[model samples]
Target: MATFRKHGKSIRVEVSKKSNLQLATFDIITQVREWTALAETAIIESKSTDIVSNKTVSDTFERYTEEISPNKKGAR
Candidate 1:
């Protein structure tokens, strides 16, 4: 969600998703709204990419733990 507030002569914009938060101050309300929309879109896109990338890492680690790690000298 995005929150807007007045800060002195400028407008403060805040966008948050999960544990990530972004903040910006702009002199015009339209600028703040535009920034907020962009910020939210970027955050959502990053989250989708992370899920796809993490699956690759998870599969590699699982294979190592099950098949390769047990054969190592110090695995005991």
Candidate 2:
């Protein structure tokens, strides 16, 4: 729950804090929602990048072991 107060012609809003209420609180609410959406987008993008890098590393390791292992031993 956010409390709203008059800030000149605009509204001031804070969550878990008390202030005088004003009709301009609607604008403050809109700004808060926008910030939340931006944060969510960043988190999703980071996860997607991590998934791609992990797959590339696993594939490279498999190739190295397969092609180079045969040439390393000389028991015969």
Candidate 3:
């Protein structure tokens, strides 16, 4: 799981994994950075409003799970 918060002008993102896989940890961090960049772009494009305010952590998690779940099952 991951948690993200904003403090002043910067955003802080933390990622945690239940498994002991080192590769999974690296992958999660990479994914988070990618998502953060996409979100930043969205904010820049939508200059009228704040991007973080329009986004929900739950929504992001759901989308991520949906994308990865199929691959996980196939691997098993």
Candidate 4:
């Protein structure tokens, strides 16, 4: 699972998963910042008509993929 916490001007992201030996935590601040910047770029560069049509369709498919396949067993 992932948890996001906001404090003042910064955001904190925590990712956790279960394991047999120990628990691991990753502090992914830079990754979150990069993703936020990419999302902002996508919104800014997208045309209104594109957003109303193709952009919405693409976003829906992306969300569906993320929801169903967040990880892969052999992925690195």
Candidate 5:
């Protein structure tokens, strides 16, 4: 299940299932809920024992620019 708590301006999301736990924070409630649902589904489906990652903010942005940003309306 996912636990939600208000952390100042952002919302903290904690999802724990089986012997695994995942934590994340988002400024938007919809984002938090979406992530929580996906995490729970992955856990219940036994996708992996560890859902945590070592990804950095810069790496995520780089991936977005390469894979997603180019598909946006302004991309040429």
Candidate 6:
């Protein structure tokens, strides 16, 4: 679900905890609705969770630093 609220002069729409889809100025409420629908559909159809749920950002970065970094140009 997307929540819309006023932000300065623009409308901010939060799709989820990690996702934010911005809307244009307050005058363009119609476009905001359309864009919201498109954004929501794109998010749903993208299967984004499948790409991210494999590992957390901290874990992935730590693994890279522990393993891949050693093979990089400089490893002390």
**Ten-residue stretch with the least lDDT total in model 6:** 16-25
lDDT of 6: 0.67
What TM-score does model 3 achieve against the real structure? 0.28
Model 4, residue pairs in steric clash:
none
Q: Candidate 3 lDDT, tens digit per residue, 1-76? A: 4466655545566433332111112235466577655555544455424225676999999987888776885654
Off by over 4 Å in 4: 1-27, 47-76
Clashing pairs counted in every model:
0, 0, 0, 0, 0, 0
Writing each residue's lDDT as its tens digit, candidate 4 over 1-75 gives: 445677556666543333111122225677675654554444455521332334677788898678755575644
TM of each candidate vs. truth: 0.59, 0.26, 0.28, 0.30, 0.62, 0.51
Candidate 4 local lDDT, residue 54: 43
RMSD, every candidate, angstroms: 7.3, 15.5, 14.7, 14.9, 10.4, 5.2
Model 4: lowest-lDDT 10 consecutive positions: 17-26
Name the best candidate (by TM-score). Answer: 5
Q: Rank the candidates by TM-score, best first.
A: 5, 1, 6, 4, 3, 2
> Candidate 4, 21: how far from true, in Å?
38
lDDT of 1: 0.83
Best of the two (3, 6) by lDDT: 6
Using lDDT as the measure, what is the rank order of every candidate, best first? 5, 1, 6, 3, 2, 4
lDDT of 5 by residue, 1-76 (tens): 8899999999999999988988999999999989999999998999965655788889989999999999999999
Candidate 1 on 1-60: residue-level lDDT in tens? Answer: 999999899998889885578889999988888888899998877742333434687798
Q: State how far residue 63 of model 3 sits from its true place (Å).
A: 34
Model 6 stretches with alpha carbons more than 4 Å out: 17-27, 47-76
